[model samples]
Target: MDILSDLWLGAQTAFSVWNLLYCLLGVFLGTAIGVLPGLGPTATIAMLLPVTFGLPPETALIMLAGIFYGAQYGGSTTAILVNLPGESSSVVTALDGYQMARNGQAGTALATAAIGSFAAGTVATVLIAFFAPALSAVALTFGPHEYFSLMVLGLVASIVLASGSLLHAVGMVLFGLILGLIGTDINSGEMRFTFGRFELADGISFVIVAMGVFGLGEILSNLENEQGRSVTLSKVTGLMPTRADLKRMVAPVTRGTLIGSVLGILPGGGAMLASFAAYALEKKSSKTPERFGKGAIEGVAAPEAANNAGAQTSFIPMLTLGIPSNPVMALMIGALIMQGIQPGPSVIEEQPVLFWGLIVSMWVGNLMLLVLNLPLIGLWVKMISIPYGFLFPAIVAFCAIGVYSLNNATFDIWLMAGFGFAGYLLRKLDCEPAPLLLGFVLGPMLEEHLRRSMLVSRGDATTFFTRPISAILLLLAVLLIVSILAPAVRQKREEAFTDED
Candidate 1:
């Protein structure tokens, strides 16, 4: 079928009453939670996965996708109003957004963010509809050797792009790979890391780990600074930007959308990186670079647009190549698995309703967010004032309930608590949880592909290098590792010279 026909069918499905309701509900919940500091779409979706068990696959997926991008809109609200970024992607937004709020332009900043996000999301959705099929066709040619090499490149890129010490990130990835080994081995049927527990034979639940690490752990971390959260609730004035403001923002938003659209398609690149890159680009290209971080409208508009665009396009790899670009996409992969669907090239061909419906729903969800956030701006402003004393307990309660609901097992709850403590410790050590989650998500696939490749090559280790695609991918992986270490090496050399001087 042609793309137009497929999209038409998708529109029919996405516009159905039930699907529309799910879309609305997802955006509503997403925006609400995103306005709250210390909560993000990852934790929110992880905590709510159990609720979707009874839902149809398309409905559940639509809602989940809604939360992912809807949070982009809501995150900027908190960033502007409270100077607290609700998600990592909003960190750049808070720089100029809070400054705008301090200058009594909170309403303008919020409106700019809302409008820029809407524009970026609309364009990104169209890009997905156009490019996903072509990408899927390319992905169909991948063999086991190529798949394994691609995964290797992805993992290395994730580690290199992640913030903090390279050593620490590597350690976290290894730890996650170890954790992913805690189940029966598919080849030998041997219990690898179950520790003599039958309940663990199937493997550790992704939801439990995600909720503990991101949801509960974030709550604990927030509690540490809860007493010091002094939000500056600047009164919002002027709900619309001036003509000059629009004129200034137009170029930045467009540039940001383009940058985000490209980066979002790369392995291990997502909203966080896209926002940072867009903000940097804006600052570098600005005639008045000194005006940045001091309420520059471009600062707010660029990152906001980039983040939303990145969020939308990041779905492409997961849908078309079965390769998750980030932790959130990994969670979506898990969700697809739960629905008895394997994510890959064939998904679009075999499940056109699911594919097209999700694409159309993203556009619908973006509209819902635009409508929902603009009218409810005042409500979100008040929500920022909610005390952590009242908030953390409710979050803890919801997390516990969600974990238990996964299997009606108290053991899972205990397991979640254990991981929560581990997560806190990891945070204290300044280790990023995102890479760990990605590693954990890809571990099984990595192992599967490795085994298949090895078997096909009759244990010949040269197979990865013999195949052109696999060789190129492995070369890229090596280059990424070298590039990451080169910076640190250069820094050390500079320090040594300074010491000698």
Candidate 2:
């Protein structure tokens, strides 16, 4: 009842004419970015960070949060129509969604994704409202050792769940960690991996790397393939799935929502892990697993739901503990910091209106996505008819402009182009980029926590293993390692990642 009253108060704040307008603007821009094939929430948000400086904190946050979730909703449109995923979370969607489009079931595929997302998002929001406070209390008890172990688990899970060879994924993670170490040492103020370059002394901008690796890299990879055609959105008949389709999807959606909610609360799992895990679980449990890559509706629904749910729940850690689970959340934290608002346990109590207002706005944002997505999907489908040759060049140009816009520096454009080419080579070698992103985000934080934990323990490493939460997390990490080493599990994992024949 208290939660409901708080939510009502929040709605009052979020539904104001001005606030709603910002929400709409964010969603509108987010959809545009998602449809553009390579741009994502990260790049889009990073680009707009400067503009929000003048807005009130709640309004700024509402807009940014709207973009984050709105992009998730819109990302599926391209994944279904063009086999292009705007976000890593949408990668699994591309597998079955693009197949469904080719098979003339684009409408059904998209409808399932949108509806499932709406359902899961609604449920997750309620869960978050009730659970976040409790979870925040739990988080308050965590010491530096516990936090360090959690970070380690997060890094391990990211590497293990990445979509490529185990060794390759680990290598990519290490590379990202190295990239993360490029800035001056925060504790010592000593230059580390700047390589004596003035521009690098501040470390590579998150915007630069995200734009280069995902945005420009996608364009360069597209250029490597001369097959330049998207599935035509000529015939979309069904807007609703049949009872039979619904029956098949029910279990997957339920399981996915559960899995995503739990994993999303864990630092580093976020939307990408949730979506991938949901798909993997669906495949494992399916009677006709072979149907997955060839346009299984469950594949579309389960992962879409899980990803959105994960994206929502990921906010819990950031809101409660002041720890960002992913880069997007990190950006949010940055936004909050800019406003002189520290995200921690006290936030909900100290600023009830802001906290509740944000929660209410999420519900509003979800509703807007459903209303907007259902109608706009057809428009998105039509974009498939655009020629890939023309599209790739535009994508390349967009990447250059977006990356350069950060500091108005041409250096970023060149850097992105270099990384884009490098990304192409990595993809050719069957390496995964998702783990790299996770590692880059977590590496510095991990080092800081590790050092802090060690100092608190008087330089004794045993503290990490002795703490109950830390011990459990370490055990889970060990289990993950053992599972990867297990011959049977290894074989299945290998087969799962190998492109469906």
Top-scoring candidate (lDDT): 1
Runs of candidate 1 exceeding 4 Å displacement: 227-235, 488-501
Q: Judging by TM-score against the true structure, name the best candidate.
A: 1
RMSD of each predicted structure: 3.1, 4.1
> Can you write out model 1's per-residue Cα lDDT over 1-501, one digit (the tens) per residue?
598999998999899999999999989888888888778888888888888888888999999999888888888888888788877789999999999989888889998998899999999999999999999998899998999998898889888777666777789888888888899999899997888998899899989988999888888787785634556673567878999999998999999999999888776688988999999999999999999999999999999999999999999999998888888898898888888898889999999999999999999999888877788887887887888798888889999998898888999999999999888888888787888888888888899999999999999999899899999999999988787669776477446444734
Clashing pairs in 1: none
Least well predicted 10-residue stretch by lDDT in candidate 1: 492-501
Candidate 2 structure quality by residue, lDDT tens digits, 34-148: 6655557875675566567688888999999889888888888888877877677899999999999898888788888888888888888888899888877787788878877
lDDT of each: 0.88, 0.79
Model 1: per-residue Cα lDDT at residue 68: 89
What is the Cα-based TM-score of model 1? 0.95
